[model samples]
Target: MAGEVGKPNGSGGLGFKGSQIPHIKFTKLFINGEFVDAVRGRTFETIDPRTGEVIAMIAEGDKEDVDLAVKAAREAFDHGRWPRMSGYERSRILMKFADLIDENIEELAALDTVDAGKLFSWGKTVDIPHGAALLRYYAGAADKIHGEVLKMSGEYQGITLLEPIGVVGAIIPWNFPTNILFMKLAPALAAGCTIIIKPAEQTPLSALFYANLAKQAGIPDGVVNVITGYGPTAGAAICSHMDIDSVSFTGSTEVGRLVMQAAAASNLKTVSLELGGKSPIIIFNDADVDKAAELALLGVVHNKGEICVASSRVFVQEGIYEELEKKLVEKAKAWTVGDPFDPTTNHGPQVDKKQFEKILSYIEHGKVEGATLLTGGKPVGTKGYYIQPTIFADVKDDMTIARDEIFGPVMALMKFKTVEEAIQRANSTRYGLAAGIVTKDLNIANTVSRSIRAGIIWINCYFAFDSDCPYGGYKGSGFGRDLGLDALHKYLQVKSVVTPIYNSPWL
Candidate 1:
C-alpha cells in the first residue's frame, strides 16, 4: 500500500470559507485497478443540487464499459489471486481497506456531501464512519463462511462447501451512496467474490474514490471495479451480462423489476434487491407524544427524506393525533434547511432537479387529493433544488402521497383509532421495508411488531442501524437482505460433495 496522504488542514467542515474545499479525485471508470476513460469518450456532468451547479464532468459508462468491467471481474474470479486466496488473507486486505477509509474519511465525506446533497456533518459523522465499521465487520466475517455436514442414511458421507458465486454486479442508489455501496461491497468481498459496481450517476464521486482506496489497500487488480453511468445503459448491461453470477440492486421498485426482468431474460442470475418503501410509523395512544412526535419528524425528514426506509406514512391514534401533529409541526420548523456544507444545517437540497420536481408534484397531488397541508409545501429557495419539509394531515390511505413511494421530505399523516386499524393501515402499502411503533404498553408493541409485514421494526427509535442486523424487505419493497451474515449468502453458492463409505457404488 502507498503511504498515507496528508489530511487537509481546513476548518474540518465542508462549509465554503476562505477558498478552502476538499479536492475531487478519481472521476473516471475504475477497471482492473486502473482509472481510464470510457471507450467512446462520453462524459456527463454531475450537478450539485445545492446550487444547481456543475460539480464535475464524470466519465459516462455504457454497455461497452459494463462488458469490459464484467470481463475483468470474470477473469479476476476465474484466475486471479483474490478468489483463490484463503479467507484470512482476504480478511487482512479488507481490514486494510477499512483502515484506509478511516484515514481519508473527511475527503470521502466531503465528496458525498457535494455529490449527493447530503448534510456535511452527517457525511462525516454517520456515513463514513459507519461505512468503515461495516467494512471491518464483514472483514471479520471473512473466515467464518461455513457449510453444514450432512449425514446420509445409506452409508454415504456428504460435505457441503460454500463457494463464491463468481462475478457480482452491484447497483447502488444515490441516496446514502457511501453506506449502501459498502453494504454491498463488503459482504461480497468477504465471501470471496469479484465485483463490478455501478454507482448511480447522480452520486458517483465517492464510489470512484473508494475504488482508488481499495487499490491503495492492496486489493488485487479487477477484484473491485466501479462504473459510473445512467441506469438505462450501464445498469441494464450489468443485469443482463451472462458472465455475472449475481446482481444486487438498491433503488426504486420500478427499476428493480426491470433489473429482475433483464437478469431472467439473459443469464437467469441471482438477484437481490432492496427496493422502494413507503414505510409507516405508528404512534399509539399510550406512547409518549413528545418522543413519538420527534421520532416521526426524524423518520421522514432525515436525509431530506431520501432513504429507502423513510417512514413517510405516519399513523397516529386519534386520541393523541392532534397533540402529536402539533409537536411534529414544531419540530419540523426547528429543522434547519440550508447549505449542506454548513455544520449547523440539518437539512440540505434534494439530490437533483428531477427529484425536486417530483417531490413538488407530490405535494401538489396531496393538496389536490384534499389532504390538509399543516406545514411546509413549497421550495425553500430559488437557486437550488431545496423543498421545505412537507407534512400533510387527513391523508387517506388511497391518496397519492400515502400510497406512492415519494422519495422526498414529504410526510403523510393519517389517523387511526384502534390497534387493529393501525396494524392494517401500516401493512396497507405494498412496501414493507420498515415500520416503527411507539407505545408504553409491551403488549401493543409486541403485537404490532409481529403483525407488521415490514423487515425492520423499531420500537422507539428511527433509522437505528447495526452492521450485524439483517435488513431487507417484504412484498414490493423487494427481496433478500443487505447487512449481516445473510448478505454474504447472496454472493455464494453451495456445493455438496458425496462419497460412498465402502467405495462400492457407481463410481
Candidate 2:
C-alpha cells in the first residue's frame, strides 16, 4: 500500500493510485502574516511515515526565528487592532476563518493524512471538520466575553474586566496537528490575543496552510504567526521567551515539565499544559459485553493510539474479563492495516520510525514481563512504519506497558474484582488525563466516575468529544483546561476597576 502513489483525479482532489503523493505548498515559516525563510537558512525534511520518504523540506526555525515571531506578536498585542477590537468585530473575522477552513477542507485533510500518517478517511470526516466546528464555536464565544460589576464594602464601586493576556505562545503536538492547533488558536484569537505558534516538525504542513487561511480570513498581520521546527529549538524558545505572556502546550509530560521550568526561569508567564496519559476504561460485569468490547477497541486504536487521552489501560470486572478479552482480540485481528488513503483502511502506520520502534519495544517488554500477547505483537509489512493493533492480557498494574503511556496501537488489559479495586488501579498511575466507565447500573457508573481521578470521564462511550466540553488533565498529565468557556479563560487575565463615590470617601 505504501507503494501506491496519488495522481491528479482532476476533480479538485488528488488521487492515490500507487506510490503517488500530493505536493505540499506551505513549507516556510510564517511571521507577521508573511511566509519567509528561517534566519539561519536551515531546513529539515518531513518524512511520510506511510512510505518512509521525504514529503517536503520545511524551514527549521530556531531561537532567532522564534525571537522574530515573538517580537511581531508582542507588537501586534501592544499596538494593533486585534486586542483592542470589539468582540463582535473579532467574531466576524473568526467566522470567516472557519468558513475558509471549510472551503479548503479537502486539501487540509489530505495534508494531515500524508504528513501525519493518519487514516485519510478519519482525517477528512473527523479531524478537519471538527477543527472548523471548534473555530465556529469559539467565534460565537467571542462576543460573550464580559466583565462584571461587584458590590463593595465602603464608598466605592468595583468592576472586573476580562482582558486579553497579550501574546500567547502555542506549541502543539503532531498526533492531531490541526485539531490541537485550533484547540489553542481559536480561544486565543477569540480572547483577542496575539499568538506565535510552534508546530511539531513531524507535521507542520497543515499549520503553515492554516496560517495562510488566517490571512485570507482577514486576520490582521502579526496577529497569528507559525514557526515550523524541532521542539528543543523553536519550542524551547517560545517557552522561555520573556515577552510571551502565556504558553499553552500539548504533548508529553516529560516535555511539559521542561516548559514549566522554562516559564519559571524566564518571566513567570502563565503556562497551560495538556500532557500524556495512560487512561483507563472500566467495564463492569453488567455492561453489554459486545458493545464494551467494540468501544474498548476504538478507544485505544483510534489514531493508531497516538491520542493523548487514549484509554490504553482497560480494566474489566472478574466476572466478564475472559469474555471481554476474547471479544477485544477478535476485533483487533479484524482491523485492516494498509494505505491511509484507502477509505476502507481502519488503521494506518505509526507517525514515524522512532514511534514505531518505541511501540515495538514496549510490545517486546510486555512479552518479557510475562503478560500474554493475545494478538498482534509484530510489524505489519516490509515497508512503512506500520504495526499490528496489539493487545496484552493479564497485565498487572506494575507492568511497564500498564504504567507508561505507549502512545501507539497497544492495549493493556487487567482484571479487577470490585469498584474500589478498579478506582485504585486506575489512579495508581501518575497520569490523570481521562477515564471511561461501562456499566448498566447507574449506581456503579456514578460511583466509579466520582472516585476515579481523571479529567474527562466517558460513560459507556469512548472518544466522545464536543466543542463545548471542557477538557484538560490532573497530576502528571498537566494543568489548565481546553474547550468551552473554561478554555477561553486560559488566554485571558482579569483587571479590577474601582472608584470612590463623589465626596463619600470619608472626606
Candidate 3:
C-alpha cells in the first residue's frame, strides 16, 4: 500500500480500501503560529508501519528547535492576547477548533492510519472524534474556572486564584496518537496556557495536521506549537528548558523519570506523567468464563496490545482457570491481524520496527521463563511489523512477560486459588496504572476493587475510559492525572490573596 501521495496505487503512497491517500501537508515545525523549517536544516523520515516504508520527511527539531518553540510559547503566555483573554472568548475559539477537527476528521484519521498503523475505522469512530469531544468538554469548562473565598481566624480575609501555569510542554505517545494528543493538549489550552507539543516521532503525521487546523481555527500565534522530532533530542529539550513552567508526559516509565530529573535539575518545573503499566484482569470462578475470556482477550489484543493500560496479566480462579484459558487460546488464534484500512482487520501492526522487535524479544523471554505457549506467538505475513495475537498459560508473577510492559499483542494467563491470592499477585508488579475485576458476586467485586493498589479499577469489563473520570497511576506507572478537572489543574497554579478584614494595611 505504498505509493505517491496524490497518485493512486503508485510509488510512495499508501492506499486504503482502494482509495487514494490523503494529501500530506504541514511537515515543518510549527512555531509562533507558522510552519517553518528547523534551524539546522535537518529532516527525518516518518515510516508507514503498515508497510515499513517512508511515508514523509518531517522537520527534525532538536535542542535549537525546542528553544524556538519554548521562546514562542513563553512570549505568548507573558504578553499575548491568549492568556489575557476572557475564558468565554477562549472557549469560543476552542469550539471552533473542535468544529474544524470534525470537518477534517477523515484526513486526520487517514494520516494516523498509515503513519501509526492505527485502525482506520477506530480512528474515525472513536479516536479522532474523542479528541473533538475532549476539546468541547474543556471548552465548556473554560468559563467555569473559579476559586473559593476563604475564612480567616485573625480578622483577615483570604482567597485563592486559579491561574494558568505558563508555557506547558506536552510529550505524547504513539499508540493512540489522536486520542492522547488531545488528552494532554485540550486542558492546557482551556486553562489559558500556551503550549509546545513534542509528539512521538513514530506518529508525527497527525500532529502536524492538527497544527494546521489550530491556525485555521483562529488560535492566537505562538499559543500552540508542535515540534516533530526524536525523544532524546526534542523531548529532552522540552523537559529541561528553563522557560517551560510545567510538563505533562505520557509514555514509558523510564522516560518519565528522565523528564522529572530534567525538570528538577533545570528550574524545578512542575511535572505530570501517565506512564507504563502491567495491568491485571482478575476473573474469578463466579464470573462467566466465556465472557471473561473475551474481555481479557480484547483488553490486551486491542491496538495490537500497544496500550499503556493493556491488561496483559490475566489471573483466573482455579475453578474456571482451565475453561477461561481454553477460550482465550481459541479466540486469540482466530483474531484478525492485517492492514489498518481493511474493514475486517481488528488489529494492525506495531507502531514501528523497534517496537516489533521488542515485543518479539519479550515473547522469547516468556518461553525462557518456562510459561506454556498456549497459542499464536510469532510474526505474521512477510513484510511490515505484524505479529500474531500471542497467549501463554501457567504464567507466574515473576516471569519476564508478566513483569515487563511488552506493549504488544501478548497475554500472560495465570491461575489463582483464592481471592487473597488474586489480590496479592495483582499487586506484585511495580506498575499500578489500571486493573480489572470480573465477578458475578458484588461482594467479590467490591472487595477486590478496594484491595487493588492501582489508580483505576474496572468491574466486569476492561478499557472502560471516559473524559470526566480522572486517570493516573499510583506507583511506578507515574504520577498526576489526565482527563477530568484534575487534568486542567496540571496546567494551572494557585495564588492566595490575603488581607485584613476590618481595614486593609494599605487602606
* Cα lDDT of model 2 by residue, 1-507, tens digit: 001112211111234333356656667888987888899989998888998988778889999999999989998999999999899999999999989888877778888888889888787788999998998999998999999998788878899999999999999999999999999999999999999999888999889889888988999989999999999899999999999999999999999999999999999999999999999999999999999999999999999999988989999999999899989998999999988888889998899999999999999999999999999989989989999999999888899999999999899999989899998889899999999999999999899899988899999998889999999998999999999889999999999999888667453
lDDT against the true structure, per candidate, is: 0.89, 0.90, 0.89
lDDT of 2: 0.90
lDDT of 2 at 31: 90
Off by over 4 Å in 3: 1-20, 503-507
lDDT of 1 by residue, 1-507 (tens): 111222221112234331234565566888887887888888898888888877777889999999888888989999999988889999999999999999887778888888888987888789999989988999899998889888888878899999999999999999999999999999999999999999999998888888888988989989999999999999999999999999999999999999999999998999999999999999989889999998999999999999999989999999999999999999998889988888888899999999999999999999999999999989987898888888999899999999999999999998999999999888988899999999999999999999999999999998989998999999999999989899988989999999878854642
Which pairs clash inside model 3?
3-10, 3-11, 3-12, 3-13, 4-11, 4-13
Ranking, lDDT, top scorer first: 2, 3, 1
Which candidate leads in lDDT? 2
Ranking by TM-score: 3, 2, 1
Q: What would you estimate as the lDDT of candidate 3? A: 0.89
lDDT winner between candidates 2 and 3: 2
Q: Evaluate residue 224 in candidate 1 and report its C-alpha lDDT on the 0 to 100 scale.
A: 95
